[model samples]
Target: MRCLENRVPPPLLMVIIGLAMAPAITPQLPYAAPWQWLLCALLVLAGGVVVSLALRAFVQHKTTVNPLQPARATSLVSSGIFARSRNPMYLAMVCFLTAWAVLGGWQWQWLGPMLFAAYIQRFQIAPEERAMLQLFGRDYQEYTAAVPRWWRWRTK
Candidate 1:
């Protein structure tokens, strides 16, 4: 997170910039069906919003938001949506970013989200895991061992 904070652009900021660059980012001729486009947009926004809300609540109630310089955690949270994905936030971002790239209508914009994933993984996700492992030890390990890094079908 320290690396993410100091070396990388905020995810939100990068998303906004990519959106604003749509004129340049988009394909010159997007021939996709209007309904299909709408569906894609909705799916992305819905996924992003849902994940964002979950993360916000988790940060507020279960953990600290300042991953860069984390304040001590009050508890080890492994219930709720977290039981499914060890990185729901990342999953959500991927959905949102995919929709965003589709909105751009150009193959080039796909790299934006991919880069975001790479950055988050390397800078935030990896470091945060190290910290959590150190902080919670075996309990954290158990939780992560059960919940996958990304996809999950079981609700409970």
Candidate 2:
């Protein structure tokens, strides 16, 4: 299991998990209401926007976006979408998976996102955090303190 860390690309892992869970998504709803389709489209669009913002932030900061090379990052990005979620790209992947599950119309399909999150949290994110801390030290710690790894809503 340790050997798997940072090895498999997240998008590939997401597709693999989704396909592995397909058999359990059987007897999907016979019909999708127009609103359900609209919801799915919205979710995918949101995911795209998030990942795009994350990528643009990385490019703007001149940091390495390679998940396999977190230590190579030149800057710690903590503004814009990054200010909200430390791992917006991963969150976007979850959004994409959630949209698929919604369209599938089966409760079990939700496991795709759940499993992906768990795996990423343990395998990808943990190691990435270690690298960030090693590279950026207190600045990385401050950023983590200010932002959740995933999204959170505020009610103030």
**TM-scores of all models?**
0.75, 0.91
Q: What TM-score does prediction 1 earn? A: 0.75
Where model 1 places Cα greater than 4 Å from the true spot, the runs are 1-10, 16-23, 26-32, 56-62
Residues 1-156 of candidate 1: C-alpha lDDT, one tens digit per residue: 463442443456457646764765456326656765896779678777768766776776767655454326556667676777777776777777767676656677778678767777787677778778888899999988898877679775
Worst 10 residues of 2 by lDDT: 21-30
On TM-score, the candidate that comes out on top is: 2
Kindly give the number of clashing pairs for every candidate.
Answer: 0, 0
TM value for model 2: 0.91
- lDDT per residue, candidate 2, 6-123, as tens digits? 9888889988987876665534545766776788799999999999999999999998899987889899999889888999999999998887788777777888999999999999
Kindly report which residue stretches of model 2 are placed more than 4 angstroms away from their true locations once superposed.
Answer: 23-30, 154-156
Clashing pairs in 1: none
